[model samples]
Target: MAGNSDPLSPRAKLAVTAGKAVAAASRAAGRGSGSVIGGRVALKLDPDLLARLAQNLDCVLVSATNGKTTTTRLIAEALRAAGPVVSNALGANMPAGITSALAGGSESKFGVIEVDEKYLAGVARDTDPKCIALLNLSRDQLDRAAETRMLAENWREGLAGSKAVIVANADDPLVVWAASSSPNVIWVAAGQMWKDDAWSCPSCGGVMQRPGDDWFCGECGFRRPTPSWALSGDHVLDPHGSAWPIHLQLPGRANKANAASSAAVAAVFGVPPQVALERMYQVQAVAGRYDVVQFEGRDLRLLLAKNPAGWLETFSLIDPPPTPVILSVNARGADGTDTSWLWDVDYTRLTGHPICVVGDRKLDLAVRLEVANQQFQVCENLDQAVQLCPPGRIEVIANYTAFQDLRRRVGN
Candidate 1:
């Protein structure tokens, strides 16, 4: 219950010190980055540490089923143009990890935090961010996280009391329903490509209606709001009728939408849209998501996609046909033990590409790819798959834990 500007209680100060020590020890032990474990230790000692540390900083929280990490990085980098900014840039997004990131950047003038979908409400309550970016919502980690609509309703209810200006996606029905009733909201037509989870209205439980550029409930008349900012083809048009070209180093239309919402969030803190985006032109990757690591004359590019919606977006980012893409999957706790979601992905999109599968759940992927009438080779690991084909740019796509394995192997 203490603020950063206010004198910290002796107990709280001790907890912060202990957390840093543990994080340092974790690095020395070579266990991991120690962000999560360090914060866990701090939370056990003082549950109010996040609130105390984040109280005085102007924070921006970005939450979604995908793109949270990259968008957070963009917003934080953009804010660097205005002043000093700190963020959970490595994707340690929960409360404990959030605390750890803020712990080290006490002198930062701004805070940009990425929040997991279910944890957004609590983080917003503590940080009371100046602006909150609500991107699209889709079925992700259904076995471990809440159901799609349930998560949206929770967001709707939890955000009712928030004073932060909400910058929400107008194209996503779930995000629209959640942020609609808020007193302050800036709508951006950031797209939602996978409509499987959004066909039903969150408010009325009716089939959604899409008559051209707009969506409304077939039964209840809850319609999509007009966006103040929209991603029009390759350009992002702001409220003043000014259009900025979207020439980002990050690939895909999904990230273009991220750039739109990010510029909107940054503008809330007095940074111009073009100024913010110009600063982000240097970012080519985020936490190794779109990293290129070349070895043995094989140009290997790593791409991470955890769910059906994510896979759909990732397919657009991979190189052209016969590029020899290695598909990997895992059913670890981090990736949700149930691999049933694999059925929803249309693997046939990789028809012309030479596909090689690997990971703990490679068998599941093989079956799914088979049923889709697509040809794929099941392999043991990245090297085995790469050896089978003549590769220039080898595309590697994996889920959460599996992606971490690939990252470690490449020394990323």
Candidate 2:
């Protein structure tokens, strides 16, 4: 591994193999149960070193069960409108990844980053951000997160003494309960909607009673506070029609929370709400999250659904195509080795839909599709699937690992 003092020349720095070697050596320092999470180093050496290099730069950290990436990107953009900024906008939420992003910057007033829940505490400790944005906690990555309560505890302990102002989503009851004890917390929420879900209380384990999309714990009666900040008004104008437009570059209910969280962070930084809203519309896609691209004559949308919550969100986005749609699933490490999460998704949304299935897990995805009564054509591989489709015009949904693998294979 290259020592901090052994600065390599620009030509040598461009070598990918050498860089990976250095990263591996850096990983070696904190051995046994101290592996890097969200790309931030475990020993705290790298971030501290990098922070000193940048002269204790002001920073913002965004953490959530979902929408961290999109929210982080939007916050970074809004901050950028004020000045230059650094962030893990590419989805590297661990310590080492945070180091990599900070290392890439020259100088900035703020380092805006999206942190994974598991690594949030450590990164928060090391980075010591000036602002922390907590989006709602939903059940995600049962294999990794274990349960939402575990994560809530992690945040509770991790952020115990943080001087940084806390921004939380009021719509998520779990977040509301957690922030109730926070010293300097601000709430952001989404209004009631027709397609809304998650009305359960995280406290006292009871079904929540909603008074117009506003939830109160049945057993504990812990009511959510109105938001200090929100993403949209009563309604917004979509191309189709006006509905509460999230004003984010991405689509869906989850993304709205992401947008609102970003706005909350921007507001904390003293960026005018109007300026934040205006800049949000200018932000671009964060790659595989919900990136749409054009092929031959078809519109291809690619989403990286890594776990049950993400999978359900992606499945819900699949509109009944006027034409046949193609769905692919892969078990590549990026998508995840365990494909059991497939059973948890509400594949019923695909019922009566025309579609095709492909990838190593094609048969498995097909079985799930069959349960929905969706007709599917089998393809030997992704290449075969894309060839079968009209090049540029098809919808492609894959888990995280599969999304990256397909992107490399298809040259997207």
Candidate 3:
């Protein structure tokens, strides 16, 4: 948020006003939250609007291919215990969305900014965050962006001069390699669900050696760092090995991992570990990720899984057995233009379940499901998909844009 003691320059103020007006107009027109365009206009007027707004902020930037939005939201909610907090609660991690988020919370004391992996360096350079959380890196937007190791190298090079204490996940090889270059780092043993992307070492390009929870490149002797905070079973363990069981409304192991990372970041901001965990429990959902919406007597729960890594985590959270599953996918600008990522995910996990596919790329998904021997029926829309199922609990898992489309269709 912009500081009260240090007000914005006149031109900057005009840009903020214009951005807010555009955002409000966007909301009224039902065009969508105007954070992107409004902030884009604001940046055009004041190219340094983000840097200027974030000048006095105690920012913590979170970047990961998956769980970034949820982790950012969890950290922001916990930081509220300290004081007014500003964050991109709407899952807008880019420059324009971030600008709108910071502008909205003018008097916020702390900023929890969710950043895209591609823009992490620039955002860190602009915000000068007090702490930076680098979650696991994996295959995402394969058609549009670099792989995990290359992206990790960019993180290593771009953040070489940063003074922020890096809160990195030691369980991920890519994250460890990137954060190892930093001057100050607080490692957390956050579990990694997917390992296909990190098979080759980032430092030496050798086959990674995995002995239980530890990973190292035998060629270069590059290994995982001992974490200050670790997740032991269902409990979160601190540096002293004292564990606290986390009770949260949000489901999935990914979210639990996110909670541990958020708690660690909150502690850096002066919020006690227990206090941060307790505050995080009060949050029932993050930008409709775990929302349960009722549609025609059946409870339709929403889940977002954009990439294979995300799908693996999300699949675990889905109800077992006869509980029907709705799989949605798209190749929109947000969900990557290439549909090749569909093959990376093993659809055989849904073998026994009644599967229904719906999305712009539903046919692509159907073809994949066919080869996996997972029988599925394609539906044109969510209503039709749910109509085909008996009234009970329905799990709707969708990619980026498809998830938003489902929310709008359900009036979420």
Using Cα atoms with residue i matched to residue i, what is each candidate's TM-score against the true structure? 0.98, 0.80, 0.98
Q: Candidate 2: how many backbone clashes?
A: 20
Choose 1 or 2, whichever is better by lDDT: 1
Whole-model lDDT, candidate 1?
Answer: 0.89
What candidate 1 gets wrong by more than 4 Å, as runs, is: 1-4
Candidate 1 or 3, higher lDDT? Answer: 3
Q: For candidate 3, report its TM-score.
A: 0.98
For model 1, residues 58-132, the per-residue Cα lDDT tens digits are 999999999999999989988999889989999999999999999888778899999999999899888878899
**Model 3, runs deviating above 4 Å:** 1-4
Q: Which ten residues in a row have the lowest lDDT in candidate 3?
A: 1-10
Q: What is the lDDT of candidate 3?
A: 0.90
Cα RMSD of all models vs. native, in order, equals 1.5, 6.8, 1.4
| Candidates sorted on lDDT, descending | 3, 1, 2
Writing each residue's lDDT as its tens digit, candidate 2 over 1-412 gives 1112444334323432333445667567643122234233322433244344224467888887666888888888888877888776777777666666666564566788778788887877777677888876766544445477667767877787888788887777766676666678877764332212355565677778877657787787779886666655423222223333345566676666566667667867888655776788876677655667665456677776666666666665555654456666777644446677677777766666557787778889888877767777898766666666654446677766667766776557
Predicted structure with the largest lDDT when compared to the true one: 3
Q: What pairs collide in candidate 3?
A: none
Q: Name the lDDT value of residue 87 in candidate 1.
A: 92
